[model samples]
Target: MAGTTGGAAATAPGKKGETPAATRSGALKRLPLALLVFFAALLYSQIQPPPSKVPGAPGGPPVTAPRTRLRDGRHLAYLESGVPKEEARYKIIFVHGFDCCRYDVLNVSQGLLQELGIYLLSFDRPGYAESDAHPARTEKSIALDIAELADNLQLGPKFHLIGFSMGGEIMWSCLKYIPHRLAGVAILAPVGNYWWSGFPADVVEEAWYVQFPQDQRAVWVAHHLPWLTHWWNTQNLFHSSSVKGKNPIILSKEDTALSQKFLDRTYKEQVRQLGEHDSLHRDMMVGFGKWGWSPLEMENPFAGAGDEVKVHLWHGVEDLFVPVQLSRYISKKLPWVIYHELPTAGHLFPAADGMPDVIVRSLLLGDE
Candidate 1:
């Protein structure tokens, strides 16, 4: 009797209809909303809804686990994420440029390679990541590194090589040093050709965008959006409907504002020079000295890579990094190559769409 108000009586808020049972019922009734708020926060954390990854910002492809070191002393950091079926005609080895890593191409490339059952191998070049850097490395030395990797991986005698930017020069050295091993080659925005063809203003500007990471904020505002640089160039590369109306042309006013900010940030982040210690231009200069510069030379792995071996060519029509005219002119000279000009694309190809299929068809569906 000292405290009849002890325990349940003390804890309970007996205010009219708000009995302990009634309060419990009210909490239960609101549980779903509470759960929803919790789940909504979780969902928001998982997906970056609209216009974050691509043009429309819709959720894009799933991220796959890239393979790291498999064999001991292999030392190369590689991504062998795509499934390689026995029937997969050949594995595609992607070589990234100076100071660049596998991430530069991996995000956009996985879809196309996976769809066609083609295996992909992208690794941080020596010195960039796990691999050791050779000072002022020549294309020959880089090619040796690639050859060593291929041999270690047992990719077989008929692998295809796809090189981007400075990587193309490394590939040329591979071809020069070990041509018989490769079945085909695809070069994207290579350096040597641009020297002969004359770089487009937009492409040079874009390269500057790539070279100067800090200038992205000002350049992006000047260009209006990050992807706009590609969009404006794509207009010349493809017909309007070819890209399935995924043109950046139709950006809404709100998106335009957001996109400009997005672009400004992305350009800054993307322009990192990977292997600056081993300048890509120096490799070219030496290779140029050895091979000698000519508008047409059999010394170019690209010049001879066309016939017998399958080749797929893509360059932005308005590509300021490399000339579309060079891409066209080169493809024309080579009878065995298939070329696609992205009316709205800049230097980079839209890997999500049908780009890989085109490469596969070019490789498999020949006169056979």
Candidate 2:
């Protein structure tokens, strides 16, 4: 200003001897604020809340079985419903599908119990909600776990098993390793072994999840880099088609509503716990990997044992997640399986109105 220069002369770096000390002082004054911001970000990253629950989520009624400590030093959580009377027709164990917990089958159990008076025991698979993770779990190991669970609950030598979707793999394992402990097996829209040949090319192409980009990526990760599968699941970076294929095969409006209800219930249960991704990843690995045994290689437990230990396979011809072709392949390999292919059903056929009654009547009560 004395030389009539612009205002920059006063603030310009090193112009009027604005020293490094001034800059240092300025940074020092900001140190506390900087530290506060850094720590705030660190805490936010570490303590982020879980995703919000889905609106109108169909939560199951209160759980009954409660958690029990298994002999292997792991916790097994389960829900028991229906009449537990000694004269109950069948003590059925319900194994839920992929990405689902024990509560997924509650509605089905309620329907069966109300109509047929069957006893139902639905347990969370290892690595699922409230149950301890089994990092090294194999199909055979799961079968043994079921046997131990039965023994712990004192369900006697044999009990009926109902496996839905991915749960069917465990049912197959039981057929292979613990046939003597099973009264019967029922699989609904079960995923087939990847190594099993005869998947129709057209069917595979039509299944939406098979072609969906996210699902393809997830499946690739699940097969090759299984350790990343859990992260992938937790990120919600995948999609599985809820409908049949490109088209809808639902029978009525009520069936459609019921399917939505089941899907909502399943979604709520999946996010109810922290380690659901672990179960999901484990399921994918076991399904895509070498199943401990094959139905083709194993002897039919009901070969000469009458209808007590029969295997029943129920699938919708339009199933997208597990194509009916897979079920057909299984039936061909194990010709003794009682296979039913509903023409107008889809992947959610089990949850369709009145289907639960049909399943219970046919599988547990031995009705035609």
Instruction: Give the TM-scores of the predictions, in the order they appear.
Output: 0.51, 0.71
Top-scoring candidate (TM-score): 2
Residue 245, model 2, lDDT: 18
Residue-wise C-alpha lDDT for candidate 1, range 1-368, written one tens digit per residue? 65764655745675654678887888889999999999988755533212212111134222232333323332455666466635565587888754456655534345655566677788866545334334445546667777777887878876778887567556556666777777777766554433333345564454544422322332332234322322322244434221122245433333334334324444233222222222322333343333433323434444544456655565666444334565566566655455666675554452435554554455544421
Query: Per-residue alpha-carbon lDDT of model 2 for 1-368, expressed as tens digits?
Result: 56656545555654365665686787889999999999988756543433322212344223334776777887677888888846567788889887777877735646558667788888888877666677778878888888888888888888989989888767888887888888888888887665534445554454534434655665666667665655555553345322211223423443455566755563464434544444666788777665545565665777788756668889877654666776776687678898888886766778766777788778866775
Where does candidate 2 have its weakest 10-residue lDDT segment? 241-250
lDDT of each: 0.51, 0.68
lDDT of 2 at 9: 55
Q: After superposition, how far is residue 282 of candidate 1 from its true place, in Å?
A: 5.7
Candidate 2 similarity to native, TM-score: 0.71
Stretches of candidate 1 exceeding 4 Å from the true structure: 1-75, 84-88, 106-115, 193-275, 279-295, 299-308, 332-337, 350-357, 364-368
Name the runs in model 2 displaced over 4 angstroms: 1-65, 106-116, 197-213, 231-256, 263-272
| Model 1 lowest lDDT segment of ten | 48-57
Q: Mind sharing the TM-score for model 1?
A: 0.51
